[model samples]
Target: MNSGILPAAVAGFSTGLSLIVAIGAQNAFVLRQGARRHAVLAVVGICAASDAVLIALGVAGLGAVVTAWPAALTVVGLAGGAFLTCYGVLAARRALRPAAAAGLTTQGTSAGSVRTAVLTCLALTWLNPHVYLDTVLLLGSVAADRGSLRWAFGLGAMLASLTWFTGLGYGARLLGGVLARPAAWRVLDSLVAATMLAMGIMLLARTF
Candidate 1:
């Protein structure tokens, strides 16, 4: 690796870590799947693969298109915010519903199959505008300034995604049994709702 590549890699890793560390919809979904021990690998695989593709595209100059099209970002941000808010409300409702919450368990299929998990993971990763902004626009712009270090930076970002999703998908499983409790489920639901709402509000606030 070139001398400049080290800084680029570090920057990329930091960017990727910051974006993935947040408790977004995708991360929540991944954790839920992990808790269920259902299609965890597939979900992580989809997330990592999607990140790789997006990071590659960004590093290859697609960030310019995103930068030029401010309207696109606005539209995407609005859509993402709406989705997050709606999802958050649903989660909060579940949290508040005593009867319905009682039957909730940490283990189950969200869509009945690994294929569905893969598709859902892909949507969660790709459909969110924030993902594009973080991985493609921000990381790409920074990587672009690195000349020959761009590829290394992209690789580091990809690795960061892989590490996070993998850890989320597998690590959360350890708490599955405990989270399977009704009260625990309610708490988790509440947490997820709060996280989603916060992220949605933050995104909307940034847009205007």
Candidate 2:
């Protein structure tokens, strides 16, 4: 790495962490999947890869275009909000039933469930408007400021996404003993339900 690139990359890494560290709909989903210890690799890969793509697009100047068309976000917001709302309801139901929540931890997610999880992960990544705001516009603007080192900055940001998601997804397994308990699962599902519902409502409200 060039001398100048080091500083730019550090800035990008820091900025990316600051934006992504906060718990949101995406993080909540990732955390839940991690706790379940099923499809962890797939979910993390999708999120990291999606962020990389968005960062690349931002570096390519697509953020500027997205800004010009707020309507695009509006469309995505509607669909995402609705989907989140439904998912949240399902989670809420699981939380209410200790048996279902407990069963979730004991049995590995099936192939069908994995497919469902992958689709949900993709929706949570691509449909959430905040992703574009944080990864594309904000990161892109900061990278643009780096001039010649912007690509380096973008790479750093991509690394941040990979690092964070990998740690979050795999690290969560350490909690499997606790999550194995029914009460713990109920609490976790409850939190997940609340987070999802709140985010869904927030997304819908923003669109309006």
Candidate 3:
């Protein structure tokens, strides 16, 4: 609310948006599911909610714990990188598979079955040290400096996550038909593989 806090809130929102707007595994999954029109809204909702909780925790001073545990952060980075690499390999394999005209179908309309999406989103959000650095440490530090307006900064960051995820999920669903193409799948797989490998290499490089 205060004029002094406006800049911090805007900066936090921009930071959060930048980190999440990328074509990461989580976003790819959400997009694929959205394209399939299978529980797209629910998936987005889960992701947004999870991010809000994490960001809130960060703004509430949980960043201090993370700041004190550099070793833990390293472990999380390694694990997250490994997980992403594995996921990338799987996606590449799927893409390389023979194209079936039938494509993916929403055989089961179980929008309420939020277990898989929720768990995946949670890991993508909380298990990655980069997330802690971006949202918890960096954003939290800036928000903390706002004194009483820390809550406003946190809200802005939280809204950024919600907006990005919702747009990604819905936007991807709108393109499910085109992306279902065999050639499109191949291209997507290649991109995913490259992205994952690059991210892993970067993480490993940082350890040195």
lDDT of each: 0.81, 0.89, 0.73
* Per-residue lDDT over 1-208 for candidate 3, one digit per residue giving the tens place of the 0 to 100 score: 4676777678778878977888766677677667666777777887888778878988898999988999998888887777776766766676667453235543466544556656666666665677778777777887788788788888888989998988887877666667656677566666766776666666666754
RMSD of 1: 2.8
Better of 1 and 2 by lDDT: 2
Candidate 2 lDDT over residue span 1-208, tens digit each: 5799888888888888888999888898899899999899999999999999999998877788789989998998998898888889988999999988878877767899999899999998888888887789988998998999999899888999999999999998998999879999899889989989999998899888
Each model's TM-score, in the order given? 0.83, 0.97, 0.81
Model 1 / residue 76 / CA error / Å: 1.6
Candidates by lDDT, descending order: 2, 1, 3
- Residue-by-residue lDDT tens digits, candidate 1, 41-131: 8888889999999899899989888878888888777777776777789889988986677665533565667776787677656657878
